[model samples]
Target chain A: MSIDDKNVILEIDGLQTYFYSSEGVAKAVDGASFSLSKGKVLGVVGESGCGKSVTAQSVMRLVPSPPGKIVGGRIMFDGKDLTKLSMAEMRHVRGDRISMIFQEPMTSLNPVFTIGDQLSEMFMLHRGMSRKDALDASVEMLARVQIPAPRARAREYPHQLSGGMRQRAMIAMALSCEPEILIADEPTTALDVTVQAQILDLIIKLKEDFGTAVEMITHDLGVIAETADSVVVMYAGRVVEQADTVELFENTLHPYTRGLLDSTPILGRRTAGKFEKLNEIKGMVPSLYSLPKGCKFQERCPKAMPICSEREPQLTEINDSHAVRCWLHIPH
Target chain B: MGPRERPQFTTMASYILRRVLQGLLVLLAVSFVCFCLFRYTGDPVLMLAGKYATQEEREMVRHAYGLDQPTHIQYIKFLGGALKGEFGKSYVSQVDALDTILERFPATFELALVAILISFAVGVGMGIVVSIWPKGCVSRILMSGSLLGISIPTFLTGILLVMLCSVYLEILPAFGRGDTVQLGPWRTGLLTLDGLKHIILPALTLSSYQLAVMMRLTRAGMREVMGEEYIKTAWAKGLSPAKVILKHALRNVLIPVVTIAGLSFGELIAFSIVTETIFQWPGMGNLLLTSIFETDQPIIVTYIMLTSCIILFINILVDLLYAVLNPKIRYN
Candidate 1:
């Protein structure tokens, strides 16, 4: 349960990111806490609006202000609280120490810039590399990511490349600086399945080669199962469960986590030539603007208890390697 | 690489050729409409001859100008003359119509260029400021003020500017392109200090609406691009906010802005009539207005054709710019 402070490159504690609109304040990421160990993949899994992306944004301190603000959080990275860092100080950490790739590779790289130009920017901005030197480094990075004819592809724009190639370019850019942490926020969600596999493999391979820590965010449990060392399951802006990937999959504690696991259709699971219906969780994620006072997942929990309706359960450690937020796990 | 390069070059060359052909077709259609409209407006012979003149004198004038010919014959003659770059002489001035319009064109071109440049610089700058700080008091004022720019008539704006700057302050020149210097065939006010002073009010008046449009477009575009995943990636890469916005977000925003700006530039040149009249700028707009009132068929037809040609050329330039700003856009 205790992680060495030295081993953890980024530790996010009690992070609360809220969005204020004319309608109401939506708690996008409410008190989400997790740590990303150095040179390991920490998967954050949740459905849309569950705040996994918001949590990642909060860590980067890239949340849009006014509409969205980080009300409170201690994003401890490199002996400094990121939330407390000045914009100027944050600039030093971003892309140089911590880099993030997004779900959309197509839109993530700038359309107007050549792949080399965009990749070279990281070098020029952070290392003060000259344009020519940065471009040379960009070609090397592209080649490192296995982009064929890297020099030629460097001259081309994002649109000239295929989806997988763009994602490779993104990975190449993100790893160009060999940052301490890389945040992959559902990085393969926008890609085709075959390309998705290739992109995921490329990310994993690059992580090994560079020894970079990764916060792999996705809604797909299969991706977490394959690539994550640990998993954080979020529901309605709250971290409902956290554990080692194998432990969480085997001993799913939170009812929401159980529901999520059940909903994922197993490959080749058919009964007597008839396809069995996938077990979907009974209800949609509670609206963030008007979340109930009780547990966010109470309405959808198959084994909802009376206590679940009265108060929300905190994420409590059930074992050395597992934590769950459910009245069922807590001893009365 | 050689084979690929050859095909791409051919595709681009063919694309340009196709666009130019389409432009020619549009010109032909426009010329036909102009010829028909001018022919039916009134009898040029009546206008040419005095009221006391005999019918024989009117007939002689009509014959002299070839106005007595059949409509089809006249149209063919007109087309043939236009193709030969000889649109005949203005009835009133007895000057070659094409030469007169061409002489006036530089004045209009100079004014439009100044106005568009001013609008582009200020508009895009304000847009960036407001988008970055949407809730700031300054941004709110700018947003509200831009509404006035959009709502007020161009002539009224010109008149108001004249009243405030010319009548009230009496600091700047009220009217006329002050002290234009002849540059070969082109007369340009841009080369002289007094001409530059005279241009301020009219250029400001002409630019107000376009500036408002560019501002709003840039603000919206920047806001949208700010939400893009790549921008987040840029920020996460430890780039300064300036670099993230100017380099990453602005480039993408400019793709659409360039399109609107190009079209607006064409419009500014064609539609500076009201501004020119108020300021007595002696641009194409002023020439066109006089020709229309005097029913100068040759000048009117030539002006229409020239304006259409300029618009077509600008549109082609805009398309080429699109390909430059966004690599995804290919004519083929």
Candidate 2:
């Protein structure tokens, strides 16, 4: 639990982001805890509604209101408690120290502005660079992202670019300021398989060059396996398991994590002489409003025990750098 | 041949010519409809010669105004006169109809320009404020106030403003364009300080609905844009919320807003009939209303043609603006 020993760039402790609506308070992120080390990629993998994106938005203080809010959390970034900072103060930290890329490249960019204008604005606003210098930097950043004809591309708008190009332009803008930490929320989800791989490779390559830590949020375990140094598996707005990527994949813990790994369609993994159906986690995801009494995954878990239905389990450390939230992992 | 190639001058020239031709076609159709409608509405001779006039006098009056001809022939003549800027004499004034309309054009333009400016400034400003802190009490008040602006009719608002600001308070002039003041050798006519006082009530009245509409569209657009991934990316880049909203959110929102504002400009010019009549302002709207009452065929036809031409021109300007505001758009 003491992830502070490492050169941690971002440490989130017991973060609780909630959505309060007429229906009820839905704990979108209920007591989630994780740490991202410097110059490393940490993948937070989960199902669609598992609060992975919410956790990332909370870090940026970009949660929508009237329904969504970061009710409780301590997001420590570069020795500053983001939750404690005023909006004005937080603005300094956003896009400067901790930048983010988004899921839908097609829509993430401001369609009205040229890519150069959007990218250069980051430098002008935060770095206080002159328009000429900012634009030059933008073109440079575009080139660094491996864009063909970076100068011309910068002058173009988001819609004019291909999907892959737009996402790269987004990356170019995010990385323009050379941020300390980059949070990419499902950055490749809306792209084709080929484009997705290219974007992922680009991210990993850029992370190396910039030495910026990354929090990669995705439902695809394959992406996590490919890009993550460490991994956090979430279920129902809480971290069900957390471990180094290799360890998490090799020795999968938590029924939800196991279910996710099993569901992945790995090449050449079918049983010999028999056609095997894809494994599906049974039962619908519990609605945020009316979750069950005990373990959230208990109803859908094949190995559910009486204790799972009776009480929720804490995220217990099972080994060095490995944690799981399950009665099975709890010491007697 | 590439997407970023600067378009050839010939291409732009051809595009503009095509647009102009299309606009002329639209104007022709509109003129045809207005000619038929006004001709069939009532007897111009009845209004021109009076009900007690002799049959010969009525016939002479009809022939004098060129209204004795068939509708199609009259339309051809009207189109010919409009093309040459010779809109015949007014039925009541005995002055050239084009001259009368030209005299009123500046006043209407001045009022419409100021009103549109006010609407843009207040609407966009309030929209940004409301959208930024959408759940705050201030935002709620502004949104509710905008709804009130939209709900109230312009004439009612005009009367209320006049009552409060002019009649009761004596702060501003009650009606009419104020007395013209000459500075040096040049007379500003309606732009003088005294003239501005007369404008406040009518301008506010003219822009009430537009102001509300701009605010609502901007607010809705901002609210939607704020949820976009690029906005989240903007914050994550360490941009202050103000910068994110202004530089990132506002630019994107302006696309739809500009469309509304541009289209509404035409509406404001045409619909000022009610506001002008209420205030007794010597604008084109007032002239049109009086001309209609007198069954002034030449003035009425010219006014309709002028308004439609202005609307068509504005539509073309809006289309060109799309390319400037959003680089994705291209005329070619």
Candidate 3:
């Protein structure tokens, strides 16, 4: 398919990211497939170690060698297969065409540099802006992110700023060159609820303004609900379900997605005239090193059937804009 | 970002002053201890007197050199002389002790400077390369080599190098700072081809410890730092590996490496005692060894005091460097 003909900016098909250690290989991301359209946000929702972060790193080509390797994948971004690009070529695509924000705002910034220095680095490195021009642009970007005393804030180091402020600065740095794709790996996870909302709002607003496609990786379902246009539910490095956000939330299909939705506490309305105890998905997430033969979540799946252990399910389209990997959904 | 507050200049000045005062106190304590210890080590009068001297002759020598004075009075006199940069005169040579130490200092300085420069360059370079491909064949080999470097003592390494390079091959001199060969009208006292050749073995021997220390610290620090969220963010920003690792990851790793290096500077000076003796280089280390055997009380005392002062100065420099390297550090 000619990807350029469509609005899809990023497309990952049959992506497999693995970690090879002395003991064994960990299939961190196995056969994951998804596409992000222009100006849309694709939320990759998963528990820790589910390979959402690895998927993001794979796209960025940032995975460390030996221990972590992208053995198989086709990561198409801006009319090029990123996995096939040379290190030098890949560099051109990074920061300029695709930029990423990280989970821990507290530590994501280089502590030794002023926020201004870090922000200006992007403009200077990719855009080839002069030092003064980059500095001016950095201040402008900080102001755009709603930072007060922009010029002064730019001069302050990352440690000097509050967590929320640092995340805002991080966003400013990420969006400095107006990248076509922005990969935010739990950008607000380190912030509190209030700050989380603010960060989420800021990201959404900035995405709207810049028209940048976003791959938002988060464990928090609430964050996905707030910012994601489409959702890819992952478990044990595999995509369990993929759907439009509203449809996925309204008609939660995959057992893992249902478990995630059930566990989150809603703002209002009591069920059966009483506040119900929060639901939790039974059992822990499976280890990536030795995932189960059939469904990775079979042991923890509340609706597991005999057939689940017998055969692994493939992600099959169930309806328009909705797909799920489950034996229950298959017609006998 | 909001209402930025820079660290006030007065606070920085006061902090520097406090550190200087503390350093002075430390120096005073160190000097006092060394003075008291050396006073009881041997009798200067006996060494000054001839083997068949009469009681009157010994007494006269004692009175002349203030050896007959109380310990407190002698200490006060010593302190007064030290303050004026005069350690009176060497007990054996009867020449100015300060001038004697200063003359040999240039040779030692040249050797030490070259050793440290080589150590930093090689160590940091190896560290960055090793960190990038920690488990690769080259990195693993380097890691093991660094381990071996750390395990061997400086003297042993010196001897081995001398045997292999000088004794076995005769490619380079095994000992001495080489015969005089002037480079230019303006000489650094070390800007000579012979000087360079003479310094190689001693400098290499001296740097082995520093190289091992810096390489290990840098590798460990780089490993930890390279895995950080900021590094990944930098890569995602589409920065080249060189840019991401060198520009972003390097600064964070340098904190620990620089700390170890700064602290090791004094150790290097102390270690030169052995390195210089092995090579027979005309440096302070040799002067110190000869003075000890000759019962030159003034030279010994002056060298100890000078070393203490250098250490204190380094500590202050390190503190200032910390403020520069890590903006999180405020002097107050």
Candidate 4:
């Protein structure tokens, strides 16, 4: 995408993940590729089970074992291959240069610890700061996140705080080290609409303040429209469309992408009727284990062709930066 | 008015108070049941008779301890004496019951303490190891071994150890009240440092099964906690596995494991009675056995109440600890 430039901080290519079970393997993420430039936001938009969050985890190599297997991928961050790093080496990158803000903030923070203990640990461990200094920095970070009465709140455990406060605390902790890239895996998915807007604003401000690249993984198309510079649309376990955010919306390269936009009730559009009810995409995201032969989306794609089921399509550039893997978009 | 707030302490406190009151009522029931059963089963007068005693002499002996009184009257007098810290005299030893127990308390406590410590260390350690590597052969073997430990009756285990390690090998003592030839003044053990020589076999017999039970519970606790999203979030934040397990997993897992441990302490007290009878370790277990053998009903009732009370008290402490570790809980 045009948004991902020379300052690219994280790049993932050809990632595949499968969950092993007695019934059969469930391929969670088949092959996906995208990059995030420094100080830019790449929104990964997909329905549930479309492997949007799995791609984010693959970059961090946080996938669980036995059931989860990453058969192919390269998570390139600042010239280093994260997938190849030893467990010890991965530790240095996980919280230092690259951090993650998980969905469901209430469950993300440690329930047994006070907010202060969880926060100070980042400074105490990474910078070898003294306890008092770490504590002060944590309090300062809390204030920066707009938490009211930061000092009093710091002493309270996770359960003591409200939903909005916990989300902010998670963002504050993630930004304390000022990482080069922040992977937010649906940070506001569990929050109410108003709180969701506040959290998104905080993420954007933090990204701009620290020049941190943000990978925003979410299912909400409205969030993508409001903030993302680039967008990657995942279908089943593969990326079906990748382009600059404006271009993806203005001239969508995949039929699935078009269906998603048409389904959303937007404010500006004046249609024939007051507003036709949203046309929900038919059928469910297919089980990844037995994905359609050529295109994972062909089973539901309105423009599905005979060849679409015969062979897998490669991610190919349709324009200077817009990429799509559908046969219909390929140059004939 | 904030969303996702914890319930107020007043509500949780009332719930906890109810639980505690119920526990006390249960203890009272246990006392009554033990008292009735003890009298119905055994002939205290006949058992109180020594190596040289005629039928007329046994009747006179029964009258001396007030066995001649009706059951209800005997209960009231016995209950009254217990309240005054007078356990009455042992029918056979002719010594104050409390004095005999006090003389034996430290020895029993020492053995139980050592066994408890070893149980926690070995059990939790093995549990963590197994959870970390569940598919490995060692995990399977360790977990299976713990189940076997829980199933085997403690007395049988004690007997088997005596036969296998003592009677055949003779490396560990088969039986003795500590190791001294002449029991000396109370200065650590009944017979100086030599008493340790006798404590070894009994302690091992006591620890093995306990260690197995603890290890099983610890493993399950660790597995459940490690699967939590917070743990995965910690990993993605770049925290090493060691920090994740030690700082996060251990503390959180201990909440349930600690309660189980406190409950097990009560079991240790019960198990010791059978264990001490077999191994002769000069603990409260041995004292209870000897007093029972001599049909000292007053002393028997006192010890039973004491054990039940200790259990009740420890369980209350455990519940209080739950509220402390989890601030969401409150005790009245």
Best by lDDT: 1
Candidate order by TM-score, decreasing, is 1, 3, 2, 4
lDDT of 3 by residue, B1-332 (tens): 22223445567777889999998898789779878766787766677896788999999998988889998998898888788997778878878998998878777877888888888889999988887777799998998999888999888999999999999999999888875544342224356777788889999999997897788888888888877877777777767767778888888888878877887776677548999999998888999999888778788888988988887888889888887787767623
Tens-digit lDDT track for model 1 on B73-172? 9999988888898888898898999999888898899999999998999999999999998989999999999999999999889889989998999999
- Considering the two chains of model 3, state its CAPRI-style docking category: medium
Tell me each candidate's TM-score: 0.93, 0.89, 0.91, 0.89
**What are the per-candidate TM-scores when only chain A is compared?**
0.98, 0.97, 0.96, 0.95
Candidate 4 residue pairs that clash: A94-B238, A95-B237, A95-B238, A294-A311
- A1-332, model 2: which lDDT tens digit per residue? 43555688888989999999888999999989999998999999999889999999888888876678887879888678888889878877778878888888887887777889888888998889999999999999999989999998887778778999999998888888889889998989999898999999999999999999999999999899899999999989999999998889889888889998888886775656557888988888889998888899999999988999889999999888799999887964
Which prediction has more favorable DockQ, 1 or 3? 1
Model 4: how far is B57 from its true place, Å? 11
Tens digits of per-residue lDDT, candidate 1, A208-325, equal: 9999999999999999998999999999988999999999999988888888889998877785577778899997888998888788888888998898889888889988889988
> For residues B211-267, what per-residue lDDT tens digits would candidate 4 score against the true structure?
887787888788888888889877876777899998888888888777877787776
- Model 1: which docking level applies? medium
lDDT of 3 by residue, A215-267 (tens): 99999988898899889999898899999999999998899999999888876
lDDT score at residue A189, model 3, on the 0-100 scale: 84
lDDT of 2 by residue, B64-93 (tens): 878888877888987887789876778788
What does chain B score (TM) in every candidate?
0.95, 0.88, 0.92, 0.77
* Local accuracy of candidate 4 as per-residue lDDT tens digits, A1-332: 45426787888878777788887888788778888888999899999999988887877888887678788878889898888888888878887788999998888988988899889988887778998999999999999999999988898889888899999999999999999999999999899888999999999998999999899998888999888998999888788899889888889878888888888877655565566566777888887667777778888888888998888888899887799988987854
TM-score of 4: 0.89
| Model 4 per-residue lDDT at B286 | 84
DockQ score of candidate 4? 0.47
